[model samples]
Target: VLRLYHAKNVYYRIMRQNVLLLERKPEIPPSKRAHTGKVAVGESNQRWCFDGFEFSCDNGEKLRVTFTLDCCDREAIDWAASTGGYDNSTVQDVMLRSVEKRFGDRLPDTPVQWLTDNGSAYTAHETRKFARELNLEPCTTAVSSPQSNGMAERFVKTMKEYYIAFMPKPEVRTALRNLAAAFTHHNENHPHS
Candidate 1:
């Protein structure tokens, strides 16, 4: 046989303190939707992944970058780099540039998926609205989960290993210039298997 005791009584004895002094709090619920697992698409422009990365220069100046990549072709479509923190304006600029690069003056014929993590810039109300206006669907990864956006994460790894590792980044101007070349080379020369 078992005896049931009030929560307060059990807590008071276990903690050796007055249970009446303790206050219970409600918990935040989890999302109803499931996490996005695979980050690949069958065709180009069907989906694009966005992510930001940062590195420091030889002089100890930090450079941050935001980039968009086509899921199917794995092409680094457009990017923006700055010495400032990642912000909504920078994300919007990259979105506009990526659209211009892929579809020119006209927007995409169909809405393209814009997958990213739940970063403030990507999740800002203005940013989502702007993406909708541009014929893009902004979708964020699961909270505090990076693996859901694996393609972009892998791209960051490749860039850090192949390009940023050896490129001369003595200053911001030079680093930005090199970054442009790196993006071009990534699209044109680097092969993805």
Candidate 2:
């Protein structure tokens, strides 16, 4: 229609002007951003990462799991599993449970880095605000770069290879029960070397 009316250039100019009106993301400071290949920490609670994964049951139902891990000790601090899709609320629950497990109902005296991928749940405004409220500094991995959260990525791989691959997947309820045991076993018996 623009070309037919000899207004193609006008349309282009209008689009160019309107482009600047699009929403822009605020700049995240360097210290609050997750750097690639920098997932390690010298001590527990200094940095923690969380990620989600999903697998199918024998009945073809999908079970999604989200987990929090300490960067220093490589411990699975807390985790949640569900047949439902992952969302901000699920991530928030894991964050609260992890904080409670580590600090015993008290928020961390220092802000701990909460590293995660740029998932909607992790990057949600509410989630980031909640993290700050809990004394956590939220940091997201670089876009399209999972290696920036390598520790959590490796943990997910380990869970899939060592635990999930061998476990019976009769149903979601049974799988959740087994996954809990797997997390416990990983924390207690798995070597962190």
Per-candidate TM-scores read 0.84, 0.82
Q: Tell me the tens digit of each residue's lDDT in model 1 across 1-193.
A: 1335577567768776644455667675765643357889899999999999999988999999999999999999998888887799899999999999999999999999999998999999999999999999988888857778999999999899999998999999999888888888899986565
lDDT of 2 at 140: 88
What is the alpha-carbon lDDT of model 1 when measured against the actual structure? 0.89
In model 1, residue pairs whose N, Cα or C atoms come closer than 3 Å (at least 3 residues apart or on different chains), thus clashing, are none
Q: What Cα-based lDDT does every candidate model obtain?
A: 0.89, 0.89
- The candidate 1 region of ten consecutive residues with least summed lDDT is 1-10
**Lowest summed lDDT window (length 10), candidate 2:** 28-37
Look at candidate 1 and tell me the lDDT of residue 15: 75
lDDT at position 138, candidate 2 = 92
For candidate 1, the per-residue lDDT at 8 reads 57
